[model samples]
Target: MSTGNTIPISDLITSRPYTSRSFLRECPERDPVQFPALWYYPVQAKAFTICSLCYNTIIHGFESGCGISFGSFTGTKHQTLFCMFGRPHPKYLYKKGDFLALRTFMASRTGLKVTTCHGLGGANANLSTTWYKPRNGEINGMVSCEACYEDYIAHTSFSSRFEKSAPQPAGQVWACDIAVPLIRRTLEACSEGARNDWRVFVAATTHRLKVPACEPYKERAAQSTRWFQPKDSLPGFIICEACYLDRIASTCIQGHFTSTPLSSGQIQHQKSLTCMLSYFPMAIAVQEVIFSENFQLWCEAAKIFMHEELCDGTARKGKSYTLIVKDGTGDADFNICQSCYTCCIDLFGFGSHFKQFDMKTHTEAGIAYSDWACDFYPTRYGFSKYMDALNEAVCVREFSVLGDFIARYQGVTQPCPRSTFVKGRRWYGTSDFSACPDCFEETIQGTALESMIVVRNQFKETECSCDIYSPSMRGIWKNACDTYDYAGFVELVRHRASVYWQTVPVMKRLLSQQRIRLMQQQTLNGSSMLYQRLDMSASASSSINYSGYSQPRYTYGAADVGYGYASTYGIEAARLGQQANNLVQSSRSDTTQVPYLEALWEAVE
Candidate 1:
């Protein structure tokens, strides 16, 4: 469908009742733009022209006191100039004809020409150096950042509260000492190119770190114990009756524990969630090695171990693998180790955090850690080297996930040759937007495993290529878009549609068959009911009352025999019954046969 008249985009967008005054019949004047308090704080119009400079000056002085310098800072005058007036600069608020004058002034003042400063941070950059803590506390739940401050003014002053409260912080500065240090380390390790890809890597890391930590802040204090209170040793904390049992099988079902036991038997109550990680550091050793530090060496060795242990002769048979090291004699034997299990699970997942070992680490010729002596092994042969290797593996895993997403979108088809639609023609892997051969075939496109699943579902021993121009395919794509992190699935669908418009005919045909099958099933059900009614009528006629129908005139070969009419009707009734049976059989056949067609339609769609 066509709209009756061509409407301007701006008019269409501003057509809503709340959007513009002309759109609504009657209403008091309200703010044109809606500001999200979660995104920015609301301050009075006057505050921007007064408090902002004071706020900026204070922050500037504070930073200066800390031996830091800000290239630029926001002032109250700028806030009112931007928020109250929709102009680029203070001069622009007064100027009527000269928009370029503001740019000229900005260049003169800063001694530099600038366009934009988007995508400035990286995942593996020295985050500590850039971390800043704003002077003002969180307002309206949003961090007080320079961008947020500017945004607050750019939109209308949302709330009158800013009028009463002190001036909002000039801008947000990096906060959280732990987060700053970790981010810094990450940035330092990342390559320049990787760092430059700020929107993807850096943003994702920061986003993950921003996840709110659990609350009900724990106060650090020593637990007081009553001397000789009980005969049984309850230790530092009480254990739940259900989970208190010792030496239970791994498969045995259980509930939340009163404490995280040292083993299946020994009880050790945890104070907090952090304690869960900190209590057993070795348990996460593999994870730390892969994600926290460089763990290339350990990853390689781990992979080889997994392949040998998990797979049976065939290279492609293994889905995943795990490794459990038994430290016969170590500090872990006497204490607790949580990192131990995590390391094995991470390797099993084949997550980017762990890297596979090189030829040297895999071979006997090179230095490698043994499960027995590695815990306290000397330098060069020490376990720290292995730990470092694991950290690299973790980084690799993260990069791998990111790289895979990028590669898929970019369509890097060199490594994995596959056919994709291009202008209603088959375009092989040589196209500019070709996909990665391995990822495309093994993960995204189609695979033996998927074929096996399809065959099993259909109860067929053979595999077949799936039709891309099918409703089922569309449904699958929609589901992936909804469930997975691929934000560009819809774009890909649009691209595919543009490339393969001709496939629309095939999809329509499949959809038509699907609709027909539904109609036919309904028809068959109706026919079955009609046949049943015919049988009931025949039964009634066969058992007719002689008193009501003294003589049946329309009997076959009646020959003036009034009493024998019932016999003739019974014969005719038997004939009708046979016909009804035939119709019922036909209806059943139609219902059964339509299922096959429906299956085919699903495959095509």
Candidate 2:
């Protein structure tokens, strides 16, 4: 065997000096060729150990004077170290007494190689493997994987407090609870105080770990019974107890929120409550509010922001507004709702490109007023592309540069044509309704079940269901794609189609009866005075305010809101028009039927 060239030193030191600050630097990448060595400072009460790589980095930093170095070192060869596999922790420096104890303990055990824990590095633990956990049943939930136990706890005074947990049932997935940030921090604090009391560490972390995971982790665990809402009532803005505790409880604006108990009845009746704070943007906004200590400013800003987020700006009572941008020809117009204009355009410094369109003046000119919708509404397909283009434009500080990208999505309400199927183009979905290459790429291309969908071979003039604006359908597709349940998705689609066809005939008969009744009523009230009274009644009803707002109530039928999929298979234009009236009538009387009807309509349309 040949050894690489090595330099001879006058004196080979067995140990090096390093400080707590020097260990703060990033650890070097692990090299498998070098056996792992554990090194620690002698004076500290820190419970964790650093790997050879980090130990070397700290020494180098000390030698280079890059870090303030102070402390004696004790070194020992270990099979594995936590720093090599777990998240970086500045407090993971070794103590000489603990290191010597760990070395003595390792020496006693012959042929023991605890290389790595199954749950180290944020990975799910293999519960069937040998692992250590708190002996007390109350806090037994806190688990330390085998590698972590050897590296951090086995040599510590509190090692006696933990016992080997029974190998969990095979196929069970469990993450080492000790790896959680809160628990890790608690352990670090315990080490700093040189506290060998296991109860202290357990008491500090038990409640936090016991709190149900934040809203985003709802699937893994149930939410707490309590939730928090803003003191200034903002509809639909709710934060789970867990998120509130973790992110908001200690914040400056914590007083601005009030806790609300979620009863079992309410939980059963309503959809799973989501924590609005879990949204990345909302979380960031809350953090900003915390930093600024301006809850009122956030509240005022949230009125418009939340309104834009919650309301789609369709069929509202108040006067609708639009931002119309004209191309060079002046004939081409791009309409954006006030919400979109304020949030997407003006917020991004692109307001100069658009002019406000006066709906009242336009209607006064005899042009019929149309309900305006934001082009970049959250539910809209290809919204991400618009956002990407906006981001690119912002990055370059040139809005005009991405004109083609903007125009590409504008007025593209129809499905891709057969001519779009050029060579080397990939399509997704079934033959009956396939997504064009562009739509697939924008929406479903990278989804989990992307390969599960059969590629369309026969190029036909079929409508693309991918562009449908129904939230329910999109949600179903998303769930199916996430779980790779292609068969279940197809079954659901077929089931929905069956229900739709069954409802269509019933809807048609109801609409026909309503139309006949209306005609009869008109015939009975043939007098002009009678018509005047009916008009007056309608006007009075419009002025009535059931809610706090004085705006007239406007109801929209399915037909009034075009799904941009009129040409979809098995949907007749006349039948659709008739069903629209029925939908409108049903919506006014029975709001529960609206989602069912909409979902069915979305399935085929």
Candidate 3:
């Protein structure tokens, strides 16, 4: 309490009339100790000699020699900017813009009365002057209140007073480190591009780093982060958790970018979040390989060079092969990979920062990673090797993706001729793409192996004129075949694993009228004396192209195998040709007699 005589409180307290609060506590064994000093709540008009708005605490700051000062509270003082004991803490926390408008930090504390009052528990209203320190010497612009002071003393142990105060937080630097390094050498899996930019400095209330100790003093320290932590060697970034969450939602997930310069305020905010891709490294791998610019180039390239058919999805049916209905085709076309089929290409969007996918879902589906990228592997991944990375970017990107496989590791450049002719089969041999002649009939064209009966006959060479290899026949076949190979699955399921059916005999008169030109006697002129019938029969084993699906059980001479390449070529040619030529059609094959190709699927009996 202040004295009318103006005696220094330090000297007056030495007279034994006043007692320290610590020594004044109640003890049942002793009577109340007599002392005159009352609780001095500092939250009053008398507590401040300087106004926060108009005041400058430094008395001799940055002047000449002895550039020192004292706070308004000390009668005899020394160097240092001073106000009360330390930076005063205001009672209420302020938000970003609120700090600048604040005029006064001083507010009311506990009310005082003339009469000395005691509580039932013997607790008295008495506070030590040292109860409120400078928040461990860190600058606090907040005004102290009775509750805050009590809170301060509650946690501050008496032993802590002798210990040195914690160091003050230095003010913040206005700029963040501007250097941005490439996430990787290649953006293969990275679906988006990023601008090299300065780190964002959010508002002071949630400043990850310490800022200026002013009217709006900083608040929380060591707040939780909302981003992937930078590599240990990299400089740390300080963004508001709000800014980070919003930035990710727009940049990564939605594949968007902002032209607006960043302010401390953010357009996006969330209650809570974290980096979405922090866990999946392979997608990170894919993203790193695919640069945004390069990905854009590839998308453009695909728009140009991809077959005209694929542009119209509904019009293009994937791979064409024979179905069970009597020589009908599956009518297939190119197809997308399993990944693309399941998710939209827009997920990466022209190239966004966050182009990630769930590998676990793919694994749960039991799909091989190869199958997942089967389409992309052959075409898109290798684009960079072929074209200029920038100018011919489209083609380069496209080549990098779709055609690079040809140049990469010197793999096959063109598909096999039979696969082109028979469109519905997926030929997975030891190579990326493969086809053998025999496999053409059973798998490619979806014909059954066990159903065909081979016939052997002796025909005079002079009469067995190889006439069916005509240009007209090939021309008609060409019209029906799909030239552009569509990305797709060709029913390449394990045929050997399928149950087989032994031959069942069905008699039909051998007709020689449909004989097509033989292999044109290319190797040996007219070496084959045997002429085989082309009609579907069960018992005989005379077909030239046996199930390429498997090898023949018994060895057979050339004479026994009489049919030639023209047999398959001419009939389809003739069938399509007759339709094109408007020629009268023959009776359709009896499909009811045909055995199921397999119990699960259409396989040969």
Best candidate, lDDT: 2
- Assess the local accuracy of residue 275 in candidate 3 as a C-alpha lDDT between 0 and 100: 29
RMSD of each: 32.4, 22.9, 36.9
TM-score of each: 0.18, 0.37, 0.16
Candidate 3, residues 486-531, lDDT tens digits: the string is 1211122122113211212121211111111122222122222121
Q: Write the per-residue lDDT of candidate 2 for residues 1-605, one digit (tens) a residue.
A: 01222211112112222322223222422222112133443222333344444555544344223222333344311223334313322223232324344334333322244344444244433424457787767584777766566555654566787899876665567676655545655565564446666667778678877676674513222133467888766876778776776667645777888987767676666646667666444554565456446555356445545554433524432333333334464422235555455445544345666666544444556876555455565455555555555543543345763454454345443344432233333345673345554555444544686676576322334333333134555566778877878788777666755675576545655556666756644444344334445444554566546666543344212454343221221123333344555545654564445556656655554
* 10 residues in a row with least lDDT, candidate 3: 176-185
Error at 241, model 3, angstroms: 5.8
Which of the predicted structures, 2 or 3, would earn the higher TM-score when compared with the native? 2
Ranking by TM-score: 2, 1, 3
Worst 10-residue lDDT window for candidate 1 reads 32-41
Q: Provide the global lDDT of candidate 1 against the true structure.
A: 0.29
lDDT of 1 by residue, 405-517 (tens): 22222222122122232222112121112222232332334322221222111111222222233444445544664466343543554465444434444455655665665
